[model samples]
Target chain A: MKDVSEMYIPTYDDVLEAHERIAPYIHRTPVLTSSYFNELTGAELFFKCENFQKAGAFKVRGASNAVFGLSEEDAAKGVCTHSSGNHALSLSYAAGRRGIPCNVVMPRTAPEAKKAAVRGYGGIITECEPSTTSREEVFAEVQAKTGGDFVHPYNDPRVIAGQGTCSREFMEQTGGVDMMVAPIGGGGMISGTCLTLSNIAPEVQIIASEPEQADDAYRSFKAGHIIADDAPETIADGLKVPLKERTWHFVSNYVSDILTASEQEIIDAMKLTWQRMKIVMEPSCAVPLATILKNKEKFAGKRVGVIVTGGNVDLDKLPWMLN
Target chain B: MKDVSEMYIPTYDDVLEAHERIAPYIHRTPVLTSSYFNELTGAELFFKCENFQKAGAFKVRGASNAVFGLSEEDAAKGVCTHSSGNHALSLSYAAGRRGIPCNVVMPRTAPEAKKAAVRGYGGIITECEPSTTSREEVFAEVQAKTGGDFVHPYNDPRVIAGQGTCSREFMEQTGGVDMMVAPIGGGGMISGTCLTLSNIAPEVQIIASEPEQADDAYRSFKAGHIIADDAPETIADGLKVPLKERTWHFVSNYVSDILTASEQEIIDAMKLTWQRMKIVMEPSCAVPLATILKNKEKFAGKRVGVIVTGGNVDLDKLPWMLN
Candidate 1:
């Protein structure tokens, strides 16, 4: 495999390779539909349910691809990443599948449940300050000490290629759709979606949904360049990160539009889904549906594919129950 | 079709007919598995997800069968039932599918979410007191006034036959299981499981799970006769009803044992499932898992089929949130 650090953009071919390589480690999650939402929006919505994926998120696809795609020499050093959320859990899961050591650098402030999950997957954790700079500095030291290959959460070509497999599966499962909507955080899921759909179903529009509280990606799309957010807050904790260079390539080139949803809209959509669709999805995953609901005229009567990115929410602290 | 009010016991042939009748109206829900639970309990568990079924519960299977099997004359008059739960929503959904009126006699104290769902499906609600005596009295009056076909939630032969279809699908989906566990209330799902498994796979042991607070079924199983509780209470609201004569016929004869879980145990299991399996299921549905976790020795290393009965929970009132 080419060096993931080289800034090499992944193609459809790389996605095909990722799909084949990660087949044994990840699940091809089910596609679900909701009649209530369909009637309310006048759009036929098909939800690609990655929440039910292994490790309770779609990041497993990228993590599995990164871990298993490693050459024997690289694999021996094991894999390491810096994440306090699903990526941390997912990378650990992937490493466990291969029976290799996985090191994670997490902020000390991360939720205990998430830390426990990382440890549950046999990941060795090195705690860092909650700041991005501190996390990066700590993660570098861990990688230097262990010689573990770095797996950037979304910026790596391998991860993007792996994420593309989801849209491939979505297209195959649903035949086709007029538009595809996904929530953008660091833009790994959206970039992967862009790569796959642009190569195969270029006619389909790709819409990136973002939380208005953390609208850096939205601002970047309009500004036509990569924009960085030092710190932003939202109920959609997963979507607080800024877009990087690799993701911005696809977002600027292939994504048809970027949409934003308010914090209340995200929470409302999340609760409504749990009540009506009877599925547990995170607030970040609800951004797509929230945007669609807010801009119904754009999606009404169209076949829309919604990527429900993950289902890793703290059960005791649901957003609706917090009031 | 045989008269539902005649206390007729349905057979495998009736189950087959019911399956065919409801095929067009109901969803053949997917069976889900969790490696975490498998490792914890040492049992190979297959969760038959009726929580994802049409109208968000397995009750839809019975409701669909009753609504579709009625003769043109009977169907024209519509159908009625008294339930403050999934059955009310299910019958309403089934009737809506058939373009027929459905009258639900629900307790006024039923959560507004459930009431709204019933109305959303075109069910006309006739409110009554929370007590069963008042429910029955009001239901009788409504039936007399509308001349609607009375569809008992669990006791009717047609309903049992319909519910039996779930096990048929479960067996087909999982090949077969060593033990099948389902939560017991009026024992509709358990009775149906008994009818199906006993006819086709009698070797598979049927276990009924009940809440400790609403332990009438557990007590009745030990006493070798029906035991009615005047007003039992539990977080598993769907399981407060005692076994009716029609349901007891199968429960007593076919079920190998009855299990019960305390309210706290049920809540813990429910929260664990949402966190780990990432599925939105109601407290009533958690009884099987609660009992399985409680009695690990009974199910260790065996292929166990779990019925996740429903997912129509109030988002604002999660049991764990009540301090």
Candidate 2:
């Protein structure tokens, strides 16, 4: 992996460029509000619904940016990534829209639904063991043979710029929010939030929500340094990744606070979201709402923008149904 | 109960008045479109999402109309209904808005989620045996003791007129649709659709969807008479009730055809809606999509309006997960 200083840190100009480049491929997902949740939280919440994004996640925003930003030659060579979640499918979706190949390195044991999504988006999958080392090793061999352009999921500049556009749209849709909350995994979304809000509305508090089981970004934020676990177990399966250097830069700078929610809380909030809001979102996406419920006093009477990051969930394996 | 001949069938004027009366209480729900489903069915489908309605169903339109249209003297005694589903919760939700007592006689075997929703909406629940005779007997006793104004779930003209407003909004939202499809239970929504479309857009075809297991409307439409079933079992519990004389008038007069889908097909369509559209809607609501898929030749290349009737599904008891 490249050193932290070697990474291309994106700027607001890059976000504007990325938005223009990806305008055709991505969806300007709707902003939804619920009076019931508003009454419960005592805060007027506007949910930036990236769950309805192209590949069922905000990852599509960054993926599309990366795909569209590539030159004709690099695009012809194709794009590659190692992820078992939304990014893998999103990258494929983006690459397919550009009529390019997207090679993905995923664990052999990844959920069938996710694999189907990747395949449906025309991604070529190379199965590896469900370990970081195996993923890296397999991705290296695949990348060497395919000679594809590498797009690091959360650590790349183009991806961050792409994800930042979601907040831009949120502001435009809601006439600007007082504060924003988003789930922090590898910190791509949070970093993008910071990147966008820090420029346009720096006064807005940028809060990050994390699963207690996989609270590396939260711990890192508190420690003023990056701290990643080997593999944390959580129902918020998308949030197992550790924060990379590029994402860490923004999270360490503009993020006001990092909050964590328990696995049960995440599940309950996910169910409540479906039951009351009539929208289907993943467990990882509910982290922000779970945190709000935990820290109700902090957000009371504020117009809060909650980024619902994704909706790629295994309907058959919903957490509430499991024994 | 009012006799079939004496019961007033709602007209377009009543629908126009109902729209004005219930405008404050009901939501003019957003019209959603899916390019994916459009490609699959070869029909440009517009979804009127009533799942996001005040109490999570289109029934709220009728319930609110009934409650709000009542005189101060009649409304003072409160409203009562015998339903184990959306209508019960919708009545409670409407009653809560007016701070009036809403008595709901629900079946003892109703799902816990429905029961909780009724309670959440501030309905007074009185349980009865899971039989029409017992429901009528218990509701009669409750009505006699409380002397509450009876609001028949679908048979009442006010409720039918209220549901008609959704179609009016649909035309306004989409300019106009070539055809409209909705699930037919007691034919309230379908009747409402007929009432509005028959007057405003006489050329638009109105279609009724039904579960094959409970295809009384489909059978009756072809037979040119109303057929009442004692009990019919389907995963779409909301579509079990047969059409009343009041609704039958509109269904028989205006509906072009009544289509039906098997239980498994309904379940598959419901899951597909959740998986692809990323929206939580009940099995009953999937009937329209199922019929669209089955009769694609008929609707191909047409702009079809699909009324997503409700979103009140038991999260734990999803049909795909059942044994």
Candidate 2 lDDT, B1-323, residue by residue in tens: 12323677777888989888999988889999988899999999999999999889999999998998778998999999998599999999999999999999998877788999999989999999876778889999999999998988898888888999999999999999899999999988998999899999999999899999999898899899998786788888888888888899999889999899999999999999998889999999999999999999999999999999999988988889897
Kindly report the interface RMSD of candidate 2, rounded to 1 decimal. 0.6
B213 Cα displacement, candidate 2 (Å): 0.5
Chain B alone vs. reference chain B, TM-score for every model: 0.98, 0.97
DockQ of each: 0.86, 0.86
lDDT for each residue of candidate 2 in A1-323, tens digit (9 for 90 to 100): 11223667889988889899899988999999999999999999999998888889999999998898888997999999998589999999999999999999988877778899999999999999876678889999999999998987888988899999999999899998888999998989998999999998888999999999999998888888999887678888888889988899999889999999999999999999999989999999999999999999999999999999989889989999897
Local lDDT at B82 for model 1: 93
Give, for candidate 2 chain B, the lowest lDDT window spanning 10 residues: B1-10
- Determine which window of 10 residues in candidate 1 chain B has minimal summed lDDT: B1-10
Angstrom error of the Cα, residue A194, model 2: value is 0.9
In model 1, residue pairs whose N, Cα or C atoms come closer than 3 Å (at least 3 residues apart or on different chains), thus clashing, are none
The reply for model 1, stretches above 4 Å from the true place, is A128-131
Which tens-of-lDDT digit does each residue in B1-323 have in candidate 1?
A: 67666778999999999999999988899999998999999999999999999989999999998999999998999999998588999999999999999999998877678899999999999999876788899999999999998999999888999999999999999999999999999999999999999999999999999999999999999999999886677889888777899999999999999999999999999999998988999999999999999999999999999999999898888999898
